[model samples]
Target chain A: MLNVLWPIFIIISIIYAILSGNIENVNKSIFDSVDNAVKFSINLLGMTCLWSGLMEIAVNTNIIRFLNKVLKPIMKKLFPDLEPENKASKDITMNIIANILGLGNAATPLGLKAIEELQKENNHKETLSDNMIMLILLNTASLQIIPTTVLSLRNSLQSDNPTEIIFPVWVATICAALAGITITKILIKKGM
Target chain B: MKIINYVSIVSMPILIFIILMNGVKERKNVFDIFLKGAVEGIEIVFKILPTLVGLFFAIGFLRNSGILDFIINIISPIINIFHVPKEIIPLALIRPISGSASLAIATDIMQQNGVDSFVGKLASVIMGSTETTIYTIAVYSSCVKIKNIRFVLFAALIADIVGMISAIIICNIIFV
Candidate 1:
């Protein structure tokens, strides 16, 4: 996806600069960007390391497992059609837990695994089931307690209080999650 | 609510404290374990460097050459109905398709409209509040070999709109 979009951006900028006669400024910006990006990455380095190390501790302390345990029953309730002990449900639960913590990179593999497990139960072989639809809905809803990446960005840009949006982000994502789940349930009940 | 916000803000420090306490309980080398994970985290940052540089260059040139604003002008009237800043139109468009694209755009928005400004805050909220629905559907449905998405796309897009609307309204009330 980036392969296609990146080049288009490059081409558009070059052409637009030529036509608009802003060629000099565009050229300077293109070169200046690497330095800025590196600086931004360095800013990110501290937080990523902090959080990842903390995640290791959380793992070692069995905190992550405890979280998984708490969310597992909610998963079963959400997808009542699936067996209580199903592997897909386990994967889905782990994925959602990771997402709730705003660990997207962590959630992705679990989400993929869940989908792969869902594919196995797909007797239709080519069509989706209601359970799969619900999983997809929840996974893509952006329900999270922390908006980690955004906070990191704000910190990089030197916000007075980087985490100020914490409550607002939480509210926004909760609304998205609720609306997503409600829409999915309504659609499924309508036999879509 | 303010108390809850403070709690969540300090939640990580508290989490680290609990984990270290548990580390001591388990007789593990807490410092060594932390160092190991931190090293891996640093590696993740370096891994992202090349892509970040490339994206930055592209986004920079686009913004500098005035193309982004030109495109924004084209879409401004339509989006004015929702009263979102013209600067964020590109973000709203690509947000559900690509995370990096939207992040690049959000950074651009922040650069243009100072980080604390309403537009910048709105961009941040929107970026963090919604999923890349089309991209996610493409990946997950393909993984499950589901050709017919049926109402999945519809429901997801509706959620995106709802998420976007709530993000705007809430940010306006609080941040603006």
Candidate 2:
């Protein structure tokens, strides 16, 4: 949990910095990181708002319903407890679609929307539901078809073949997603 | 490559166009609906802002304190047992922590090793295959105010380990 990991990260880094005599860099990084975080959030804000707006249109026009139908089999299998008519199903489908298209920024807003919907059905409200944990796992082990950022970075670095690693990326990502889902399923089944 | 680039570029615009057209055909007040959702987006961002600031600060301290290199030195011998490249150990470690930090490390790797080198290809595959696990989980869980994430973190990290190891093996078979 973040409650435990956050402090450990800071404590370990501070002690390491002191021993290495790199305390100044750590001090500078604190401020620099805050600044960077704000800038990053602002950048995220625009894209998120844009996607959220577009999502509204998609929902109002039944585009989400169409997408949900297309993704029904997969969603049903992954979230068997939920009804096909659930709002969370639509949000999850849109998030997965955006992710598959490599729309990283767009996917975050939709993913948050899906989590919000899932929270509505959560009885405990504090602890994550099984489906919520599965959603997070899916995001962490992201199944992106094209890694736009990596390809662009490689192109900028003047690689002879900018997209040469796409196939390998697919292989690794599929393996990751499968592994995460399998472990989560087992843990949930064992009442973890 | 060109076709992939083109699809990636046009996909968003095309999606947007389709959504907007659908809204019009449905006779909805498109602008009003958009504003409503955008407002919700603002609230979501505000809720997660503090989490982002804290997570970034911790990641920054970790990355700048020279600890990752120390950790890498300690783990390289163990990692060598699997025949994985030592140069990418830092990347596999950092990939799940911070996106920007991993990007920096990946760029550094490709620059030093040449973009077409075996190490470079492995780094690229790793970058594409993994996500910033802590950040994504923190933002989502915090936004919905979930206190206990349970086994999600454990399972996700397992996924990252599998992904990174697979990247190394796949790169060896395909690139080398």
Candidate 3:
């Protein structure tokens, strides 16, 4: 089903791009943006490190433990297969925390760690477990509160009110996260 | 380059110490694993490079071609029904393209209008919350080895609708 639709979608996008005169600009941008891309990457590395360090500090100070205590009942409801003491559960929680803070780059390592832990528990050769699917859905639709990265970009661009988006961003992300989770569960129930 | 090299050099020993404390018995083989990881990272980057370029080109061409304006015009009536500014249509349209590009557009809106203005706040929310469609599709599909994720795409689009609607509702309540 996807195989047929994927090509069609790509073709349509390509036609749109060509019709819209973006192909030429895109060609120019590839070269023109390289320097900017490099600079952005370097700056992002620094930001990621700072955020990761902060997260590490939080963990060491038992902030994570506190979060776990607060989130335990919710986590249990979301992930019944995961024991409270499971390393994967902890990694998943950390990833969610970083994402909520809009620290996506900081969440990558934690997400990878979570995946590694999940793979270890997957003894079966075929099909993802319900918990694994749920984790992926959650990660993909992780609700953000602060949207730090977006605000930073706005500031860099000299916007007067960089933090103004916080309220709307929080609402949108939370709703999207709920919708993604709900749809995933419904699909699973229908045996998709 | 020099600063990056210096940082890497300083960090190497710390990484090694952390790995050693983790009880990795084959401590000497850690270098090999590190190199392997680097290679794998590079491979993944190259694998996605073409798609990334394609996505960027598509977005760029669309913006330049006035397709965005056409889209805005068509969607304006619907958006007006919700009391959202017509300018926000473009940002919403581009949200699924590239995060940075959408941010650029959103920033432009904030600059033109007051950032605290209803439209600016709404655009910011939409930009911050939504995922770039192509990037999400590329990442998740590649991970699960699912060649066809059409259903997932539909599901994601539906999720994006919810996000957009929520952005409006929340902005009206808090920012307006």
Candidate 4:
């Protein structure tokens, strides 16, 4: 899907840039943002490393297991077909925990691991299942606790109070997550 | 807000302290383990390098080409009904598809409007609350070999819309 969409984005951008007679600005930006983006992602590494390392310790010390113990029932409710003791359920809980902590890049592999496990549960079905859809909804809405990236960006840009948006972000994301899950559940009930 | 503030301030210290205490109890080389995990974390950063490059490249072209303003002008009337600023339409449009683009735009917004301004606050809230919907869908579906996305796209998009609207409301209530 991204394979197709990515090229189209590039093509349309170039064409539009030319048509708008913004060729010079566009040309300048090509060199400008590319290097900056690379540097930006690398700069993200410092924070990600700290979080991921802490999470690694949490996993090693069985804190994550305890979290899974608490979250399993809720997970079972969300994904009725997933067995509480199964690998997929555990991965899902781990993914959710990582996401709630606002571990963006770190959460992707965890989510993909979840999808992989869910695939196994589906007996290798080529099409998406209801649980898969629900999981994706949860991921997209994200319901994060600390929006670290936004805060860091704000701080870098010298916001008087970088973390001021924390409350609003949490409230807004909860609404998004609840609405997303409800919509997915409704769609599932409709057997769509 | 206070709870969030405390959590944001205290969560990291508490987490690290617990990990240290656990490491001591468990009799393991936790520092080495941490370094290893950190290395893996750096690898994850590198893993996203390609996506970042492509996204930034496209965004740079599109944004610099003035296509965004043109599109925003077209959508201004509709969004204005919801009291959304014309400047924010770009952030809302690209946020669900590309985080990097939205980050760039949000920085620009803050740079232009001052971080505490209504539009600046709204952009921050929206970016924080919403996910890269299309990218999430694409990565997950392919990972699980899910050929048909079914209702996933609609659900993600709707969630993004809800997040955007809530960002607007919360920003107005809190920051405006």
lDDT of each: 0.77, 0.89, 0.63, 0.79
TM-score of each: 0.69, 0.96, 0.70, 0.85
Ranking by lDDT: 2, 4, 1, 3
DockQ of each: 0.47, 0.79, 0.19, 0.60
Which candidate do you rate higher for DockQ, 1 or 4? 4
Which regions of candidate 2 are displaced past 4 Å? none
Candidate 2, residues B1-176, lDDT tens digits: the string is 77877876788789899999999998999999999989887877777788889988998898789897788999999999988888888888888888988899999999999999999999999999999998899989988888988889889999999998889888989988
**Candidate number achieving the greatest lDDT relative to the actual structure:** 2
Which TM-score values does chain B get in all models? 0.62, 0.93, 0.75, 0.77
DockQ of prediction 4: 0.60
Candidate 3 chain B: 10-residue stretch with minimal lDDT: B19-28
How do the residues A170-191 of candidate 3 rate in per-residue lDDT, one tens digit apiece? 6788898789778877876786
Could you arrange the candidates by TM-score from highest to lowest? 2, 4, 3, 1
Off by over 4 Å in 4: A33-37, A44-54, A124-126, A153-164, B1-4, B28-47, B142-147, B174-176
- Cα lDDT tens digits, model 1, A47-109, are 777765655565566555666678767876678788756777766876787677666764655
The TM-score obtained by chain A of candidate 3 when compared with the true chain A: 0.71
lDDT of 1 at B112: 85
Place model 4 in a CAPRI quality band.
Answer: medium
Lowest summed lDDT across 10 adjacent residues in model 3 chain A is found at A53-62
Predict model 4's lDDT versus the native.
Answer: 0.79
